[model samples]
Target chain A: MKICVTATAEGLESSVDPHFGRCVYFLIVDDGSMDFESVPNESFSASGGAGIQAAQQVLNKGIDVLITGSLGPNAFPLISSENIEIYECATGSVSEAIASYKNGSLGRIEASNSPGKQGGKQRNGSSQKNN
Target chain B: MKIAIASGKGGTGKTTIAVNLAISLGNAQLLDCDVEEPNCNLFLRHDMEEFEDVTLPVPLVDKEKCDLCGDCANFCQYNAIASLPSGVMVFPKLCHGCGGCALVCPENAITENTRSIGIIERSADWSHVDLWQGLLHIGEPMASPVIHQLQEHISEDNNVAIIDSPPGTACPVIASLSGMDYCILVTEPTPFGLHDLKLAVDVVRQLGIPFGVLINRSDIGDSRVEEYCVSENIPILMKVPNNREIAVLYSKGIPFVTSLPGWNNRFVHMFANICEQLSTRAAE
Candidate 1:
């Protein structure tokens, strides 16, 4: 199984790149039992739409599961629409998050963990199209 | 007149000067454009009276109609739209809500949707000063929408509108200073202060707005800030000395101008001088 782990620091485990405009990180992990190559998340530095880029990277890799400490409103739905699974409340090292995902200890979150229900609106898998 | 109290750097007493100046000037309105971590409300002690949600128009793609031609993705200056072989994706945070993608889409697959990013709260202490604050949601990327909402509270009747801009010279800062009559760049006497001060000066100058500097903690650090001001011919409007008493008062949420006697009068003079300088420049 291939998994993408988003961590605060690089190389400890795959860490979710913190959004430049908003603060938060995601850890995505592949849960399938297949041998998969690990790809480090490319840092997207632009002020707007970093989440989309991150999601696309994960989706392109055919990542099945994401393990992270928190997810924000912007990237939360995009990942879900790609049929990727999200596991929240996993913390500490990236290895630990992966371990939790493998053991089914990581909790599934259908919605975002953003405070004040900020991410709730975007969880419906509707693609936000701003042309 | 719209008077913006801003510093190129943080912790330079921008909020300190803004809160006090609004209070002393009485009948003025204070707009805290520092939406990320708005702290002016902490000092004013005004009960928040009204709250309004702020959102930006992000794109919503109808997957059934999207041909994934990537035209919408190509049209986005920010690369917010991602076109894959099988589907189209929209990254809302990266989307500037320009609506250009929808305009150029041949299939007309893109539609506009609103996503709430923050909230603008309105409150007052009945002391004639009104407080309008923008609070950015924890994970939302765009802050300009909230800043725009806070701007709606700008009272034309108020003789002065003091805007406390965000720290950096980014989109949020630009949104705060847009259409302002005067921008007061606040800074301290330090190397970092000077570096950011120059960056901020470049931004304001590029925007073609009339501006000046107010040096806080003037007694400490190097005299480089003064040198820069002289070299740039930017007027040094006022200087607030670095004092422990002022620091303590600030931590306790007391406006230094009121807690320490005579500071309010200094601000009055400073504001008057700013107005006079602007007028003089206009006449010239």
Candidate 2:
């Protein structure tokens, strides 16, 4: 099974991006082989509907599961409709998050936890400070 | 003349100037293009009737004709349409109604469908001032479409048209300000007001519309706003001092121009000055 984690950087050592829609990279990992492909999220700077666009990219990648800090209202429905299970991990590196998922420690995100337009650095584990 | 009264900061008296100027001019059409929270009707005495329903054309995909080519999805800048492996889904709320999707669809699967976004209303009671207001439905993301429709309803018979544009230099403001003969930017003297006013000025200047500043509550803040105006070569059309009576009257939803004496002549003079400026520019 393939799993996608919203990451701040290109590697597994990168912290999980808090925002699913505006993440810098999507690290798609093959669960069995421990192999991975890093896809830069083009929709990170989209003015609107970044979540929907990001979700479409993930869906196109045939991702079986999604791991992110939070799902916005616009992106949650699109991801959920595709039957891709989403797990919430607001902290730690991408590898740690995947390990937690394997150990059944990450919480399942059944619905969107973030409000519309609260795209990045406003929720948990955001490195940027809100001025 | 089509004059848009816009302010970058909210509660800087855009509505106050719009309603008062419309009434003062007489034989004018006052269009409230601030659709999201249209409060012009609250301040004006009128029996408003529903003029027309405003709708946006969203895309409707025909599944049978759609080969899952993802052309429509790719064409949509809004990402409102998603072409999943299972099927294509169109999110109407996210759609900007640009109609690019339908044009891009090679299979001709995408069709235009109307969705009600807002409504326009006209005042039946007020004879001198034809008050037209646009009301956007709750949870509606786009206000520019509604503003575009509202401005389209400008009566040809009216001598002057005053548009109360929505706050901030965004899409909705552009929609309201576009194609206007002139724009009256209302602002206060505070630092916040001055900052936003600069932004609004940039928008109007970029749009190539002749605009002048009308400083509301002119007495409260520092003289930096005046200095900026003088340096920028922007005309300070009118200055309304901070008055306790005006605030009291506004709280009661009463237009101070009608309730207070001597204000009518001041508004009329301002209108005449604007016309003179327009004519001077035309002669040049």
Candidate 3:
């Protein structure tokens, strides 16, 4: 299964970006091989509908699972519709987040936690909650 | 002549000028184009009659015909449509109602449907002037559709029409200011007011509309606004001092022109001055 992690930078050592829609990079990892490729997020600076665009990009990548800090109103529906499993990881490096997910230690995000258009606000605790 | 009363900054007295000027003119048509929060009706004794619903054409995919071709999703610039392998999802709230998705669907799966975003109302009982306002539904992001509907009610017979425009230089404000013979850019003499007023000026200039400045609360801030106007050669149409009486009257939702009879003549004179400026510009 391929998993995508929102990251602040282009490497596994980079910290996880707390925003799904506006993350600087998306780290797509092949769980079987533990191999990864970092792709820059095109929707990071979109004027509006960043979440929708980001979700669409991830869906197009054939991602089976997503690891992010928070999902917004615009993105949650699109991601959920694709039957892609989502896990919440608000801190730690991209590799650590992937390990937690592999071990089933990370929390599954059941629904959208952040309000739409809160790109500038740092949303914590809610996305990190184990629900 | 049609004049739009617009302020880039809110609470800079766009409605105050619009209501008073329309009342003073007696034969003018007043339109409150701030659909999100229409408030011009508050100061006037008028009976409101519901006009019509403002609707936008959004696409509805016919699943029976749709093969999930992804064509409709690709064509939608607003990202309102998302085509997935399992099913297609349409986010109506994000839709700009451009109808491009329907046009692009080769399978003929997309169909157009009207979604009511707002409504318009006409006021009766305002002795001589006709008052109309647009009300945008809560949570509706677009206001231009309602403003467009309200503009359709502009009285052709009335020589003067005044639009109380929403604050800002965005799409809604552009919708309100479009096709006006003149725009009275009401502003205060502060940094925030000047900054937004410049943005508004850019919009009006781009639209190629003749405009003048009306400085509200003229005495409170610095003289930079006046200096800017003088340098730009933009006419300063009128000035209303920051008076305690006006503030008190505003808090009570009273138009000061009605209580202080002298202000009625002042508003009328301002209107006449605007007319004179328009005529002079036409001659040039």
Candidate 4:
């Protein structure tokens, strides 16, 4: 299975970026061999709809699962179409987040973290300040 | 000729300048394009009449014909259309009404529908000034459509029109200030005011409109704003000083010109000066 983790920096030691759509890097990892591809989020600085754009990019890549902090309302619909599972990873490094996912510690996000059309840090509900 | 009074920051006195100037120069039209929080009507005290409805075309999809190809979703830059496995979803609030989704659909299932977001109100001011203002519905993000509706009320016989533009150098400001003959850039002297004033100046300059600064509450803050204006060679058209009585009267919903005596003539003279400056530039 392919897993996409939001990362703040390049390589495995980078901490998991709390914001999914606007993250600096998306680490697309092959769960079987632990091999990864760092796809820099081109839509990170979009004036609006960055979440949906990022989700589209990951979906096009055939990512089976998304491991990130939270999903925005705009991105929720984009990722949900393919039945791609989304897991909430609120803390730890990208490697640690991947490890937790392997151990079945991360919880599946059924509903979008953001309640409405509002996005990013302003998103309420499942989104936390610490992460 | 149309003149727009715009400021990047709120509370910089756009309405104060607009209302006073309209009263000062008789037989002019005043357009309050600030649909979100229109306050021109507050001082005008005229019984407003709804004239027209402002609507924009948004797309609606026919579910039976749609194959869930997701082409519309890919075409929409705003992500207003989402093609889920179950069906297609359209978020009207997020849609910019660009009409691209309908064009990109191969099945020709998308159809146009008008969504009314705002309306225009008109009121006559004692046969001297005509007031036209746009009022956007609450929770409506798009404001330009209503502003455009208000602009449609401008008639050929109307010689002078003063547009009270909304605050901020965003889409709303651009919508009101676009194609204006001249813009009276209103600003205060404070640091925050000066910072946003520069942004407003940049916008006017980029649009290639002839603009001059009108400093309201000039006596309170430092002289950096004046110095910047002088250095940039942008003329200072008028200076309305900071006065306690003016604020008190304004708070009571009384226009300063109505209570403050000599301000009426001062605004009239300012209007004359604006006409002279604009004509002089045109001649050159």
lDDT of 3 at A11: 87
Per-residue CA lDDT of candidate 2, range A1-131, in tens? 99999999998899999889999999999888879999999999997888888998999999999999888887898899889999999889989998999999988999999886733323211111111
Report DockQ per prediction, comma-separated.
Answer: 0.13, 0.31, 0.22, 0.17
- Sort the candidates on lDDT, descending order: 2, 3, 4, 1
TM-score of each: 0.72, 0.94, 0.94, 0.87
- Candidates' C-alpha lDDT: 0.75, 0.88, 0.86, 0.85
- TM-score for chain A, candidates 1 onward in order: 0.64, 0.88, 0.88, 0.86
Q: Alpha carbon lDDT of residue B82, candidate 3?
A: 84
Error of 2 at B99 (Å): 2.0
- TM-score of the second chain for every model: 0.95, 0.97, 0.97, 0.97
Report the C-alpha lDDT of model 4 over B1-284, residue by residue, as the tens digit: 89999987778899999998988887889999988778898988888988888888888999999998999988997767766656777877678889999999999999999898988989943587799999988767678888887887776676689999988787888899987999999999999889888999999999999999999999989999999999999999899999999999888888899888899999988878888988999899
Q: Which stretches of candidate 4 lie over 4 Å from their true place?
A: A10-12, A30-35, A115-131, B67-71, B82-88, B124-128
Highest-scoring model, lDDT? 2
CA error at residue B147 for candidate 3, angstroms: 0.6
Q: Candidate 3, which segments miss by more than 4 Å at Cα?
A: A118-131
Cα lDDT for residue A46, candidate 3: 77
- Model 4: pairs clashing at backbone N, Cα or C within 3 Å: none
Cα lDDT tens digits for candidate 4, A1-131: 99999999887789999888789999999988999999999888876667777876787788999999888877876787779999999678989999999999999988789643343234221121111
Worst 10 residues of 2 chain A by lDDT: A122-131
In angstroms and one decimal each, the interface RMSD of every candidate reads 11.0, 8.8, 11.8, 10.1
**Cα deviation in Å at residue B263, candidate 2?**
0.8
Tell me the TM-score of candidate 3's A chain: 0.88
Question: What is the C-alpha lDDT profile of model 1 across A33-125, one tens digit per residue?
Answer: 533354544534543455556666666776667766566665677777777777774446666666666788877868756541233434211
